[model samples]
Target: MRAPLRSRPGPGAGHHQVLFFIAECVPFAIALVVLTIELTPAHVVYTGPLLVATPALAAVTMGPKGTLAALGVAVVVSVITATHNDAWGGQQVYTNLVALFLVGAASVVTSRAVQTRRESELNQVRRIAAAAQEVLLRPVPARLGPVRAASMYLAAETGAQIGGDLYDAVQTRYGVRMIVGDVRGKGLPAVRAAAVVLGAFREAVHYEDDLVEVISHCGEALRRDAALAGAGAAGDDAFREAFVTAVVAQIQEDATVELINRGHPPPLVIGEGSARCLTPAVPLPPLGLEEFIGGPPGRLESYPFAPGDRLLLHTDGVIEARDGDNTFFDLARAMEAMRGRTRQAFLEDLRDALLEHTKGSLADDVALIVVDRVDRSDPVRGR
Candidate 1:
């Protein structure tokens, strides 16, 4: 089996640390070299300016705390080196003190400016990501052609606007084509893979004549991107490991729903105070993991989705979610708890149950899509 994709650390935290460390050390190293060469008064004056400027540079790159720490180190180095050189008093000592004080003051100002700019950039990126998430996985309308739907997405990582989990629905000539998927990783690479899959799924759902063809098209798109990246040997395994597990379905006028499962957990069909899994007859390999001579795509499975039938499709994040005791979430048990509940109640109850099961924290991104066929006997809004 291929190794799972590892999430990259955020730039703001890790990058700041590395840059701050380098910035703090550079001037200290320069001072040491000057001391070795027998530091002169002229050298002391020139080096003093650099000692002050070094912490300011650190502030610009790493913000306030880092700048303050660098400044403290600079002061200690200057006082110790000067004392050792027998130049601790007189005009020379005053010059060093003035430089140290100026460096600390400059660092304070620069650090505040850098922190303000960083916060602004972070806010802007979060806004953009929020907009992108809404566009990519739109809220399921209160009602579709013959179904009422609702969905929820919760990213695993805190402050993460989006991740690899995806869902989409659209009214096409065929019917209400919908899908929910989970890419193999987290962070930007997984997000990029999700974008590729979702972009292809949207285009294919409207244009492709068959659901199987639509799934194949999405797989082909990812494969092409992997090849282009020269991910040749390394890329091939990455694509395989970065596979997407998904379930795609279409609802017909008579309430007959057809669906295909690609290595995804089966969706649950809830009706008449009972819940059951809609397992596909022939499950196919996940997208982006096609073997050299892959078997034909799975046959579309069909079932009668009578009025009041609520179908719940979700990523493994739901089942895989764990509690403090390390117990996995039992979705079936939760559904049983909500037996005979109204659509809205069912959703709310399920969300609450899941949150409780995971103790409000999940290790993977969770996406839930619920589709319910409305009762036809109920008053028709318009003939």
Candidate 2:
């Protein structure tokens, strides 16, 4: 519900533009003063061309009204200066006035052209960003089997639609399996790593018989991406330096939740009157860094996911967001504040609190999901 504050298009915002208009008038004022001097040189046409470039800059920083106003001022100043220089000679005055008009017209045309080009480029970039977001993280289903879920994602990057944080839910035979992960690094490298993890989950979740095997498939995907990247000299750096911290969970039909976590932020079990963090007892290294464990998969963590209980999963961005005093956002304390709220309402409130805590600017990507255990036995509750 809360989004970063973005600059509005069309004219440099508010009073900030008053300075630009004032600045644009300086060159014309200087050129006009030069023409009015008694001992001014006969050849003074060069100063007029200087006024032509002002409109181009105005095009970027000003609205159409402001841009035209500046251009109008430019034309008036240019005509007055030319008339004062050639007061006695009609033909000379006519030629100079014509030249100024021609150049002024060119400036207007150039300003409009530049604006058009810039607009086109912006439209293309937005389209591409939307497409990448759609392919990388499609909309999460509202209902995954018997579970009711609501998800939210906020990419901290201003221009980046897709970032390192990722989350997805799949209804597999194992149950409604879910994943929330963060790829190390940023930009394209991080996006690629995220894609690998999600692709593995979507492709192998239904086929893999064991939960650890699903994690293994995701690891192999990372290795393949590494090998492909290792072809270049700096390629293997991603293999060594790049990694993902993720938590994979399976929600069974009997309302039992199984979690396999690897150095990721813990999930919260939010019940009617209680909120508990599911921290791992023997934490394993991140999925890509399997060499540290050098053994079989770590045992799955189990929790009682009864009816009316909700599970909340999120990336490090939420906990690591800092305030003015350099204090990190406390997820546990925030959840405690949402004591009587529904799962969807909690996620919404959490997002708002995070934005306010960070002062509307974030240094990392955030992805979160809240899955509620449906009470099928209650006649008042409809599936």
Candidate 3:
């Protein structure tokens, strides 16, 4: 496979940071140039305009305090240049000082106003994102019916708490049903698709007895959402192509799991110090492409999730992560290495391992749900 594109910053990030530092120092650099020019014996060029521009340039990146600091340096340099040139009593020098003071004051006030407005907008965005996360990705209960479960969502984009990857688990009359899926696109469109699928799963899992029917409901919801979204934007049929790869699994009280995979990475069953992928017997297209099947719903494959066994459902982000050498992350090996920890700890260690393998740069959003089958008489020790 071609190298995956990472959302997190890479080697060039340091270079960009260096350029930013240089930009911030531009105001100081201007002051130094003025001082150097004044010290020259053959200097007839007036440096007043350049000195007056220093604080305004600093205001672009630095806040009010930094703007004031730049102004102070400009004033000190102006005085020294005036003394060196013996132009202290001249009207031109006095006019230049007055202009510098006025410009510096204006720059400081503008910088303070911009900083306040920016902070307010940032707070508003953070609040909205937090609310969206709670509704779109509700936390899976640590205990669901006969199993103990935990989930984690890692968004590849910086400052993003949620993304196209989504998962949810809920106790139902039939059994404990759970879903793990990834949307085909990114940003708002992908988030909208993810919300539609998850909303369908949360509602259908309780009423739909058959696992296949639950998945069918999710598929129908995706199409309806796409049609509605497409109606608003003229000539924007992109939503029609936005599909979601998902796996819906139901675990009965007897510790047996029935899964219907929709073009997603197969779930893992870990037990006795080994892990195995529960590949689906009959493959089905992703949710939006259900028309391609042209028959009954996807087959429900069964697996013996015995007591003490752990089931892991995840998006492709976990397995497709590549190290510096282009080798895929060894998820099975990592899971085996962290087998005996508690559900929460196991997931934390797994996340750390994934990050370490990719050096903290992930190409896609990751969503994971781990379910453990425990016998009530003898609760699993580390669970």
Candidate 4:
């Protein structure tokens, strides 16, 4: 039996909140300690430096507002301590007060400037990521020939919208052809490879009648890209060892699905009340490593895909996610639980379940495409 997904807060949420509170309170806490020492008979020589540093410390955690508040507290403490020590009218006391004001104002301005620059940089990054997503992972249509399809992608790294994972669906002259794949590495290199494969796939699907030929075109494209990248970055071994695990599926008008999985997780098929994996008949090495296979690329394996059946194609990230106890996520069980949901809802809830299981921490990028075979005559369409 699979464990139910717990819709609780992220595991690190409370811990991060506690640490943030402590960091925010440190400046005020230091001021209180300094005041207590000044009031005592310890005769602390020079607390001016410590007092001057409080606003800067506050600026780091609380921005300009907290810096101003800390400046106020430091000013009040400095006055009270000076008066208590009977050093009120001395040049040293006046100099310390002036220094405090200067430091506080500087801290406030610097903090505000830094915050604005950071926000601007963040917005710029968002715009670039949005554009990259649009170009790299073109949206799968809601209706592709005889099947209704939806896709979702989640990048593993923070502030990233796309990564090594890739998927695309196209309605070609033959049928509705789709591909879901993952580059062997990550970051910009992986993205470049993914772009190459998708570009080849999109172009080849239109001309290549056979699914095998489409995959071959992607492999050729990846090899060419790797060779080009290797030439520019001399002695780089990433391109030499680069490979992509992929699966290409074609759904014809007769409701038959053909798949050529190359070292990737099998696609799942869900019927009215049953679901099963469409494992490849002869497993082949990933793209860019065809030399190791010793023969032609694997042939397309066909399976029954009746009307109203749902097909799930995904990268390994879906199953490789682990919980606090180090248990792997059960993809088939999750699909079973979310059986009756509408197309979009099913994908959304599936993502939520994955997040819940992993406590919002995934180790790798995830890309999934769920497709439903629908009759042309059916009045209802995918939403």
Candidate 5:
């Protein structure tokens, strides 16, 4: 059985706390050792390295705050050591204090420099990732055959360009094929899985003659890669869980849509003045979780998609998004607010609602795609 997903404290905050705690305790440990040893002249020789190491240690392990704290502790230790040894009356005390002060200052400066350098490198990485994400999931043109469209992809975590959730649309010989899915994990691994799914989908969308065959081909691709990498078991389980829920659709030339659901959140079809869930019958397993061949593919459900009708596909990140109070956002209410709005307006409202719902801190990445059919007689081909 799959483990239930839960929100946890940020790893970065936890790492900071642990580093601070360790740095704070180091000074006390040194003081205890100094007291245990008799106040001898030889002890002063050992104190020099400790004084230098304290601030340097903090700078390397923690940040500015930690380095400052370490410096303060070192000053206190120097004063106590000097007074105990009757060295305060001599110039040695002044020289030692000056040296310790310089060390602390250097540590502080070094820490800030290191922090700035790391931030710059991270920003560069984020930019590269964002650019790659754009290339992998390029913008879907406003029109796909008879459909007009718009989309939004929001990473739940700050400074993240893409996550596990993914969506793609392409015009194929069969029709305009689209997919929305979520991977089971996060970070680089999830991104890799998403890329695999998308890459296979793109190839199959053009070559495969049927939607089911396309899904099966993508499944085979994932399975082959898993087996070749000796990741068959883990990969199978990961894909099964990640994409355990997905929805695939093909828009026919006759303005009808045929869809397949695999334990995924049903999509919403907005028309006239209301939105309705396009629930599937005889739901199949998610693409990668087809462990065994089943009976013949189920019949595809059809819906009349007239000009101006809009269909929205989204990952669970939207509905499952939680706020500080841990309450889920009202997806239905958001959709209701989007009624009667243009495709662009609808997406804008949805994005605004998601931000408002999570107060700008969502725990899961969101990937949404909208397809709106344009009037057949309208001269505007791509808008």
Candidate 6:
């Protein structure tokens, strides 16, 4: 598993803060040097620009009041220096003071304008990101037939709420079908692949009766999208090694679930105060790489999904998340501890555990879906 990208807080702010602190000291030091050592106007003429620059720099890290304070000090110092040089009434003082005031005011205005534009751009980006996330990972219905479901996606990239990992669940004439998959890489390429698979699955779930056919539909969709990107934005090299590891599931009204694993992590079956693995008996190749298979792929694995049972399908991010000591997260241990948790609580706690193990950041994109077989007579759920 690839290690996820770790995020840092306020990187740009920290850098600016350091520069601002240093800038603050340099201007004051230069002014003190002029006030003590230099008496002639020619020797101190260089200090005018430095004094004006201080307020401009302050404008970036400080508000209007703070910037105004800096400007006041700079103007006062300029006047005092002019008086000491016996040039207070000359055109030199007027020219120097006017330049200082104009430049300082311009800096304040420029900083505020730049800051406002930056904030607007950030807001627009966030809005676009949220819309893309919704379209990519459509919200799962809380109830699908007799099942209770909840899903979560943890994106490894900084400020990215969605990534190559994708999950979707929908009710069909045949049954309730769901797919959880991960693209081979990260960034836009991976995201494009994920979008292809999701679009295929969402459409194929309605038309295809067999889960195997649905898997093929998703694979063909990936191949077509890859072909379109041929020698373009995404090259053959990316498509060559790029394949999606996926698991497609069909939950029958009879509480039986059929799983088709394609090089993805196995789902967990939690019920009766115990949790167990529901991995396919036969190994399967990942989607879009079945041509590499010499023979047949893995057979469909079925297991009884009784009332009150919960199914957890996840991407590699959760299992591969590492701690400070490089220890991998233990999913089985977490499931064992949360065997009887409600579907919603299980997903919430599971994410918390993954974050705790990884020190609040994951090494890769993660998508998790929890499916609960509803028990109409259950005491807690009945209320």
Q: Pick the candidate with the highest lDDT.
A: 3
Off by over 4 Å in 2: 1-46, 56-70, 76-97, 232-241, 378-383
Q: Model 6, 175-274: lDDT tens per residue?
A: 8999999999876778888999999999999988888889888988988877777746535557545799999999887868999998999998887766
Predicted structure with the largest TM-score when compared to the true one = 3
Against the unseen true structure, what C-alpha lDDT does each candidate score?
0.75, 0.75, 0.88, 0.87, 0.73, 0.79
Q: How close is candidate 6 to the true structure, as a TM-score?
A: 0.80
Error of 3 at 118 (Å): 2.0
Which residue pairs clash in candidate 3?
none
For candidate 2, write residues 1-383 as lDDT tens digits: 22343312222334656777776666445545544552256544355445565554455555455466656766676566656655545565566456655655665676677778889999999899788878888757778776877777888766667788888988888789999999988767788899999999899899987888898789779878887787767855754467899999988878678999988999998777667899988888887888898666787888989888878899999999998999999888888788657656777788888888988777688888888888655443222
- Against the true structure, candidate 5 reaches a TM-score of 0.80
Q: What is the C-alpha RMSD of each candidate to the true structure, in Å?
A: 6.9, 5.1, 4.3, 4.7, 5.5, 5.0
lDDT of 3 at 379: 57
TM per model?
0.73, 0.80, 0.88, 0.86, 0.80, 0.80
Alpha carbon lDDT of residue 332, candidate 6? 82
Worst 10 residues of 2 by lDDT: 1-10
Model 6 poorest ten-residue lDDT run = 1-10
**103-166: candidate 5 lDDT, tens digit per residue:** 8899899999999999999999978986887877676777777777777777765456677877
**Ranking, TM-score, top scorer first:** 3, 4, 2, 5, 6, 1
Which stretches in model 6 have alpha-carbon errors above 4 Å?
Answer: 1-47, 50-94, 234-241, 375-383
lDDT tens digits, residues 201-279, model 1? 9999988879988988888888777666554555445444577888998887886788888899999887776778888
lDDT of 3 by residue, 61-180 (tens): 889999999999999999999999999879999998999999999999999999999999999998998888988887788877788898888888766768899999998899889999
lDDT for model 3, on a 0 to 1 scale? 0.88
lDDT for position 308 in model 4: 82
